[model samples]
Target chain A: EDQVTQSPEALRLQEGESSSLNCSYTVSGLRGLFWYRQDPGKGPEFLFTLYSAGEEKEKERLKATLTKKESFLHITAPKPEDSATYLCAAAGASNDYKLSFGAGTTVTVRA
Target chain B: GAGVSQSPSNKVTEKGKDVELRCDPISGHTALYWYRQSLGQGLEFLIYFQGNSAPDKSGLPSDRFSAERTGGSVSTLTIQRTQQEDSAVYLCAGRGGQGRSGANVLTFGAGSRLTVL
Candidate 1:
């Protein structure tokens, strides 16, 4: 079974502080790795998709990178609005569009 | 719509009752997915639809759960004799018709919060 595990279940940071969340996974043949941001009572919003090691994508203050065994989401100079649950999911080559997600890291940025 | 849309944003029901949740994918998206979120947990895949054809449904929890899509468009998930364990947020997502490297990309709705009494 494909599995994903995220570390630092929760994190608190002051405004403009920077931190990185981890997403480790084990899959037969990773087809894609995805990052999503979800707010309380709202569904997840797509962020980035990493398909290979050494690949990276960034949006505003968020940057996502992938390696063979894990992926990292780095937030730089975060603001209170950036506070949300960050989810990591992996889709294996064996399954088409089926995603296995990690428990997620809840990030809270204080202003 | 601009994004995936789900109906009945909130539903409170008694155990043993049946409920139906609906999803309207983005206009041109050919793939749709249903997921369950319990409290603060991660998303649990419930099912997926590829152009109105559900090639996989093993993620569904039990026989009491069934879903269908028509005309290659909207879809619905029906739960029979609901239980308290069924209380959670039901989220629906959709992806573009073509794009394997990015096939896993999903756009989600706000989700429907279900509460079983």
Candidate 2:
């Protein structure tokens, strides 16, 4: 079975603070690792997709990197608008279709 | 529609009652997925339909929960004898294809919040 685990269930940071979220996974024949951001009362929004170790993708204030056994989402100088739940998921080649997700890390950035 | 659309944005039901949730995927998308999200929990895969191929129902929690896709676009999830534990936000998403590029990204709907009492 594919398992995805995230650390630091909740994070509190002042505006402009930078930190990173971790996602550990054990997937058979890993295919892709995904990141998503979700706000209260809203569905998650797609963020990035990492296909292999050492691969990285970035957006406005978020950068996602993947390794052999884990992935990291680095937030650079986060703002209040960046407060949201960060979710990580992994899809394996064996099941090519199913995605296993983590509990998620809820970020609260206060300005 | 511009993106994945789910019906009955909010629902309140009693135990033992059956409820049906609907999903209308994006145009020309061949892959559709249904997931359940409980408070403070990760998304739980429910089912997925890819084109004309057989759907993957392995993620379904139980036999009471069933889903079907019609014409390879819209989908309906039916939960019979709903239980309190079944209360959650039901999310529907669609992927254009299996490619690693844009086609692989899943576009999600606002989700249908189901509350069973």
Candidate 3:
């Protein structure tokens, strides 16, 4: 069975602190890995998609890197406004397009 | 361009009542998806519609959940005999069907929050 697991269920960081969240997966074939940020009362917002090992993408203080069995979302100098639940999902080779998502890591930045 | 849109941002209904949630995908996006998110939980895939072909309903939790896409544009998800456990945020997303960029990034809507009393 394909599964995704994220580490550090919750993290409290002071403003300007940098950290990384981990997402590990077990699947037959990895088609894509996705990262999303979700705020309260809203749907998730797309962040990045990594297709192959060693692939990396970035957007405004957030960087996503992928490997053969896992992915990492690194936040640089995170601010209070950047606090949100970060989710990681993986799609398999079957083209089912059904993303198996991790439970997500909740980050709270204290000012 | 307008992103995916869902109707009735919030809904509250009594148990055993039926409810219908609507999704309007971005114009020209042929791939639409539905998911459910319980409080503080990750997304649970509900269904996927690719063009006019039959949808993939494998992820639906029960037979009481059904969805249909009309004209390859708007889609509706209907839950029959709602239960208290059915309460969740229903999210809709859309992507270009084929020949798009790698992996076809999904655009999501604000979602509809359902509460069963």
Candidate 4:
């Protein structure tokens, strides 16, 4: 069974603090790993798609790195605006195009 | 709209009543998807439609849940005998072909919040 798990269900970070959220998965044939940020009352916004191990992507103060077993979303000097729920999902190579997602990690960057 | 659009941003209903949610995918997008998100939870795949292909309804939780896509453009999700457990945000997404290798990203709508009392 394919499953995605995100750890540290909730995190409270002081403004400008650096932290990393974890996403571990078990899939039949890895196709893609996705990261999304969701704010209250809205759908998730795309962040990054990591296709292979040892790959990394960055945007402003956010960086995402992937490995064979898991992926990490690293927030550098996160501001209060960065506070949101981060989601992780995995898509297998079955052509279904369905993504299995984790429960998400809620981060609160207090100012 | 340039982005995916969903109707009735908020719906409050009594248990056992049926509810329908609509989604209008971005124009020219061949792939459409529906998902459910509970409070503080990740997305739960509900159904998918790609071009003229048959929709994959494997993720639907029960037989009372059904969806239809008309002309491969707009889609509707219907839930019968809604229960409190069905309260959640329903999200719709559209995916366009980015390249020949099937590299595409899903653009999501703001979502419709369903509250079953």
Give the count of colliding residue pairs in each prediction. 0, 0, 0, 0
Error of 2 at B16 (Å): 0.8
Interface RMSD of every predicted model, in angstroms: 1.6, 2.7, 2.2, 1.9
lDDT of every predicted structure (CA atoms): 0.92, 0.91, 0.88, 0.89
lDDT of 2 by residue, A24-111 (tens): 9999888789999999878889999898999999999999999999999999999999999999999987776777889999999999
Model 3 docking grade: medium
User: lDDT by residue for model 3 over B61-104, one digit each (tens)?
Assistant: 99999899999999999999999999999999998755222356
Model 4 scores a TM of: 0.95
For candidate 4, the per-residue lDDT at B6 reads 97
- Over all chains combined, what TM-score does candidate 3 have? 0.95
Highest DockQ against the true fold, candidate: 1
lDDT of 1 at A56: 99
For model 1, the docking class works out as medium
Instruction: Write model 3 residue lDDT over A1-111, tens digit each, in one string.
Output: 679999988999999999999999996678789999999888889899888899999999999999999899999999999999999988877653678788899999999
Number of the candidate with higher DockQ, 1 or 3: 1
Sort by DockQ, best first: 1, 4, 3, 2
Looking at model 2, residue A57 earns an lDDT score of 99
Q: What is the lDDT of residue B107 in candidate 4?
A: 86
